[model samples]
Target: ASAKARLIDVFDLSDVQATYILDMPLRRLTKFSRIELEKESGELTTTIEELTAILDDDGNLRQVVSDELAAVGQQHATPRRTLLLEANASPAKSAVPLEVDDAPCIVLMSSTGLLARSADTEFDASADIARAAHDVIVSSVPATARGEIGLVTSAGRVLRLSVLDLPALPSVIGIPALSAGAPIGAFVDLPANEQALCLTTLDETGCIALATARGTVKRVVADTPGSKDSWEVIRLEDGDRVVGAVRLDDAAARTAELVLVTSDGQLLRFPATAVRPQGRAAGGMAGINLASGASVIAFGAFTPTDDAMLITIAGTTAALPGIDTGSMKVTPFAEYPAKGRATGGVRCHRFRSGEDLLTLAWVGNGPVRACSSSGVPVPLPTELGKRDATGVPVAAPVSHVAGSL
Candidate 1:
């Protein structure tokens, strides 16, 4: 006790161990007490060395904290209240910026409203060998998987479809080999009895040329922003409906001419500027003066240097069902004089026997490909000719024509 008192005075005994020693009971101060104090002092010295080593070594200090935390966690662990899944650990609704493949793809739409995507725009196969039973492939347009496609309806409405949303198809196989495609209604809402007329890609800034069966035409700005899935393109008369709609790029809208084809083989070519641009709801000006029974079947835009292909599908009547005997001929746009709007245009294709009606026409700057009902490629005229000539018969019955190939 005396030695401890002297030691406490000599050394600054401010530590916990020194305090306990200094406060020892007076009755336990015996020789045995001295032995006990020595043993405890030795033990305390060992503990001090271990703690000092732990403080000096960062790895050992970290281990001590980890072990203590683990012990506490094990003793107080609780079950999670929320369900967790390995497949969807993160609650992400969609990719940031929507990672869409920008590779080029071909958008195919059948007359029955089935839609599919293919990598090759020039893909060709027989209709019997390519398409499903009773399905007619009507339109195929080349677009990137990231581009927007416009599904123009006979009701004169436009439905926008993202190519990324379209089901991807095998490039080598025909349409019949794949599953029956989704309907147009799957992507856009449509009114009862409303059917799609054509599939076209939208331009960044341009106008949409719309032509109706009653010979009315309108040009609506293509870039008009809207949140709705579909938009009004033209106002139809009581008995008339939109037969065709095409998107004209800024270049095409400025310099291209509009070509309107009739069931009676009348072809009207006029500058796109001839008719002023109209609003979406405006009833359009006259594009052609249809005869009593004749109606417009196709409308397209082309530049003067571009060669246009007019396809006349032979049938008993001017309808898809009557498209049996078909002929496709290419004509230079310079050959056909640009007539005034609402005028009766000159003849573009002379009627072959059994084919007095024209089924479809396609106008663009690039090479055009015509196909039979079965999707097989039909040969186009090797030699370009003047306007208003009889077209050569296709190798098989033709049903559709695709331009800008």
Candidate 2:
């Protein structure tokens, strides 16, 4: 009735008994009599022939048993456990009980009042091994509960703080001319050698602020207060005029150049450099009426219907097909009207990548529709909403106002 039960499982075998069962000389077992086998039924016994047969198999039986017993010993070995205590408790009385299948050779409490176990009897309670085990357990705790673990290094740095413990990032800093109390709306970093000017309406006074690498501070316009629609023109070193007023949404640098949309839906570019006082009237175009007149200027590759013409000092002229400028023929120096829309006002137009112009027309109360330069309608993003100065969606409930800067 010899069964395959492990030799160690059958009796309270000591380490020596296990070793003898696996490593005893095979010649000793072959001489055992039937009476001895009956007396030690569960004991290790084998004949020379049995040993030879086991050896002849693909795998040796004794070797297999030895390997299995070694694995079992390791599996049943006393495991190190750690128990973290509250910060207010003292280690002498606050140490928690550690449940284990086998008793450890040594047990000690950590500086954080955590219970630690080890197999070596000479194990130091403050040794690196115990500390390492304690640290592993504490580090694996959730970030929210890590503060309760009360574990710190010699240098006073917390051990288990995770990313969740860190505070949220601060908003981008250093905005120009932004009042300390005013909330920031938009921001943009100007290119090197580029200056951004902002026009702000403070206390009903038109104030101008220049943003350079040096700093952002406001300067009084010193000019006459005109209509809110009054524009500023600046002349560039390249002999081009940047026409338009500037409005600052945040401390970010913004150019003074603005695009004005007239009642007739004509777009014009007024450079910031060419702005100057013109008689009693201080408006853009320097008193130059471009409605019936034609001016050639280099404009962006794509322009909305609001930007119909660019009034630059340079001899560069670009056409914006988004705005139905009434069959206006775009020439080198002038844009002449070719045909006019039958009805309804022109809608906002935008240029896609390259020279592709997209015009969005608000025809009646239906959905805003878009069309290509060739009179072909195009699809737009479904999430289209009122965008802020930086093209981000504006929160619900918006208000529009007019003022000069």
Candidate 3:
């Protein structure tokens, strides 16, 4: 009664509430009801003590406020709507190029200008090509796996390719074969109707020699390494286009002979130095005067040491004697007197009765081997003979250059 009276006094209960409490039903004052009221009273007393304690210390009060705020935040939280990036994550104008270790590699280009790289210096001709049925290996070069390769197009432009950028192929049957590769047009923005003619490794120490179908030739200083932009290596006339490109050093240019073979079996050999080095954009000077219906088929720098072999399209192989380094006097096997530029070259091979043209010419110091278009080995006679001899025929036609990877 005293506790109830004190509560009513603290709450300022009116006379009507006091009367109601006095007139409470007897059922409302059961033992369970008394126990529930006692529990509620105890909870209220504990809450009052906690509130007093929190009010007594600033830290306790702040903690209570922080806890309430956290609870409210958790109940009302929503998912984020914007993403956050790193402080320096802005987009750039160009992508960074990749760096790789230098290793031996073979770069292959298809007839349709597709390009690929293999880790091996040699390819398995017997294995199936990693390209379409119509595509064939038109040009290839041995170079460092990470070196830069120059791609010459029929339009006389040179597009640069990093050997590392090419896809590497797996080795099968002891030789690596390019399984798949990107097209040259993807890396080079070639003009319409332009097609890739040849491929060569690029370096700063050498010069690039270009030969065109119309018998024009030019030697241009090689551009510095690491350039990705395509440049004009040779300027061509309306009807003329590049057919071949060779790398030559200053010393090699002085002694090495520039050999050009025509479709009619005519071969011209002259000092490479005869054609002075010109700028990349300069139109090349005449290299040979093509006969009325004859066209230049192949051009390369020939360093004669032991022999030069002429392989005809009809599969005839003839070995021509070269520099006789064995004798006390280094005598050439055949005296191909140096001629002025634009002169029709002397005969290199006498066409057989049925044979019409020559397809490949090789110059090396040691014995040479023949590889077929399908990667099989083709046998050749070991006999060394005089120049301008008729080539011995084989079973199949020689489609590409001998020893060209």
Q: Considering every candidate listed, which one attains the maximal lDDT?
A: 1
lDDT (tens digit, per residue) of candidate 3 on 191-297: 78776777866776667777888899888887743534677887788888877776666676778777776877676778788888888878989899898877787
Quote the lDDT for 333 in model 3.
30
Separately for all candidates shown, the number of backbone clashes (residues 3 or more apart, or on different chains) is 3, 25, 3
What is the alpha-carbon lDDT for the whole of candidate 1? 0.71
Clashing pairs in 1: 126-374, 127-374, 127-375
Q: Quick one: ranking by lDDT, best first?
A: 1, 3, 2
lDDT of 1 by residue, 1-405 (tens): 676666677886755656676677776657678899999999999999999999999999999999999999999984332322256576668746756669888887864566777777664443235233313455666689888788888898878898887777665543332234666777887888677877776665677788888888888866544576677778888888887776666787888788888888788888899989887788989899998889888887657454455544434465456345566677766677778999999887777777777766765544455555544456667776557777776566665665542
Q: Which window of ten consecutive residues has the lowest lDDT sum in model 2? A: 175-184
Question: Residue 207 of candidate 2: its Cα lDDT?
Answer: 30
Better of 1 and 2 by TM-score: 1
| lDDT digits (tens) for residues 49-74 of candidate 2 | 67678778756877878999999999
